[model samples]
Target: MSFAEQARPIERRTLYDELVERVRGLVVEGALQPGEKIPERELCERFGVSRTPLREALKVLASDGLVQLTPNRGATVARLTVEDLEDVFPVMGALEALAGELACHNITDEQIAEIQDVHRKMVACYEARMLPEYFQLNQRIHELILEAAGNRTLSAQYSSLAQRIRRARFMANASDARWKQAVSEHEEIISALESRNGEALASILKLHLNNKFHSVRKWLISQENGTRKG
Candidate 1:
């Protein structure tokens, strides 16, 4: 093969993935919404894609619990129930604890600074009351820690669990007090990582996640009850 041919940029994203993202974005933005039927035809028209790829994406989303598929009723965005949080939280706590432990030993000073930089920006967002931006930075800080943990298997598993709970995380019911408390906890996370205290980081991360689960659970319960009423 020619060098030019070999050097050409590969199309890494599949049509199915692009379609899945389009649908996922709609769900996260509250457009598709929990329990609302996925408008497959409208989506196809919007994306200018055929039903084959769109249906394939729907199946993928169903497996991820972002959407549900019914025999005759078709697809709707999945609701994250309190029960769902109950099942997922313990698993997430374990993964987060594991990541925290690993990261303290493996994280470099430069990497630590990078995470701190994002944390600083996150605090700014919180101060500015820019929730959407704060959520983005919050996810980035967590991702950096997972990366620093240096375990592909742990990162992959943690990432999967993270994806499953992202809707709740993004919609977390953070009262002003809760937001302040979260930022304070993040300060300890940084301190532990900087001091290379693996056990301390693990406990902090696990406990922090435990607190986070309750906040999200409150929101999920309300959402579920609201949906029922509507």
Candidate 2:
């Protein structure tokens, strides 16, 4: 290898970053369920890490609103209450609308084509009943729009909120009707971008996020009630 190539920074990930990602995966995949106490010793054993890094990772997760850490009770996965969802969705909707508006003004033909490719792939995933893959691609489509918007501040804020609410993707698995409805929304989103209709895209994006919030909130309420009854 050339000296110049070897000298370049490769963006190394710290042990804490790795641990945080692993724990996040556990929660998102339902291995660490909401409101369930995180077994610190068991997680350390599974990941082959020490207590220090595990605790550090948990702290990060808590800040992201994924894990709730208490003084005496330790950490449990956070339950998404109706109030929390209501609080977040409006912020997300407004950011998404702004992104859509700016994306239409700034997006290049190549960028649009790239997003379209992901859109097609996402549709295929939906057709195959691959919820996880579809969810990831759907997120990628939104990410590309945010990136194309070319506003660093908007992108950063939108992305931080996006990460905090990433688990809401799982709620789409609750019903085929809602899943299909979301796919339909994505269809309009792609069309809006294609036509460079900024206002149309902004409105569509806001409505889509609103619908998603409602769907997830409904499912969470049902689960909460079921737990109460049992």
Candidate 3:
């Protein structure tokens, strides 16, 4: 009721959000690796804030399962296992499938045109041998599909999940061949969407995700085997 009280609550919320973004960005950018401890003084100085806001942000990240907080050791980045991937990726695939189905139902002509343009740009990136550029376009196309799904909650949830897997999702595979395969998969997904076939689009999306999962798994296994042999 009082202006002071009202202003305090708003300020608290804003600081909380700012801190959350700071910590999340560090994790996403790999400035903080999984299971690595966050330096308290460094964060305090970098953010130009006090311990209160920094701790609040870490708590929020811990709540998101993005970090683990201990009594004495403080917070460390969350480490994901292959089993974690098995649990998380399928849920992501289902959410994507749901988005694709909804996109088919609610997509506007203008949105379709935008996605088409992105697809064309994506192909151009592939042809130019600019895989990083192509991957960015690929990400934009998927985000567009989720936005066109017209469900705010779904979009937010999917985005959060994607953020959790950002590192693994962006890791390079064995060769450029994998990049080419990814481009081909994106083309099929766009074609299915353009034709307004929800079922086909969903299937393509699932396969696209599975391919990434398999590729990552193979790479991880090879690394482990190499360590064993060494």
Candidate 4:
């Protein structure tokens, strides 16, 4: 079959999903920074799609807490505060800890191996000074861990929450020093899991998330100081 003949026609449903993911990635990667307004016409041209699909994608992103749509001012990347983390992280920690405990009983050897592979790749990215790529792998590792937990509803909820949280973290740090410690922390998590130490894994993961909250707190203070000076 010729390439074009074999290629399936782009489905409207698939187009919307891809558009949402692409636009969400822009915000998550800081390509569209928080509080930055999106130029709709520009985006339509850039994506080579119509305004209808683009608008649909924007609506999805807004629903995901990545963008805020104003009555008249169109859409902009959502600005997150440290207070946001204060409200969200604890619940997320509890859920993830719950997931880890369940995962201990549900995980298969193949899943464990996949997790290990992601960790190894993350370590390599860290060594290569590729913070962005490293963090992406880090996310995959956590997701794999959650999948191993085998709780469908909890996994879906966590993924939604995490999408919002990841956008904030990416905006705040982009490439911060604490990323190094984060890599080492994942090492501990993998080690604990390998030993089937569920309790220890839960504790470590909780502490890891708590530390993130602390870091966000410190960053907020710094931002406040900068604002006062300016």
Q: Name the candidate, 1 or 4, with the larger lDDT value.
A: 1
**Mind giving the per-residue lDDT tens digits that candidate 1 earns over 37-97?**
8988888999998989999999988987788999888899887778888989999899889
lDDT of 4 by residue, 1-230 (tens): 89997797865666778999899889877788677899899999999988898889999888877899998889999877667768788888998898888888888888899999999999999899886787689888889989999999989788877877785555455234677777778999998888878898898899888887777667766766775532
Scored by Cα lDDT, where does model 1 land? 0.87
Instruction: Write the residue-wise lDDT of candidate 3 on 60-122 in tens digits.
Output: 898887888999889989876677778888998999999999999898889999999999998
TM-score of model 1 vs. true structure: 0.89
All candidates: TM-score: 0.89, 0.87, 0.87, 0.81
Worst 10 contiguous positions by lDDT, candidate 4: 167-176
Extract clashing residue pairs from model 1: none
lDDT (tens digit, per residue) of candidate 2 on 1-230: 99899999998987789998899889877777778999999989988889899999999989888899999889999877778878888999999999999999999999999999999999999999998899889989999999999999999788767766677646646688888989999999999999999999999999999988878888778877878732
Q: Which residue ranges in model 3 land beyond 4 Å of their true spot?
A: 1-13, 223-230
Q: State each model's C-alpha RMSD to the native.
A: 2.9, 2.6, 5.1, 4.5
Order the numbered candidates by lDDT, best leading: 2, 1, 3, 4
Instruction: Please count the clashing residue pairs in each candidate, in the order shown.
Output: 0, 0, 0, 0
Cα lDDT listed for each candidate: 0.87, 0.88, 0.84, 0.82
TM-score of 4: 0.81
Error of 1 at 93 (Å): 0.7
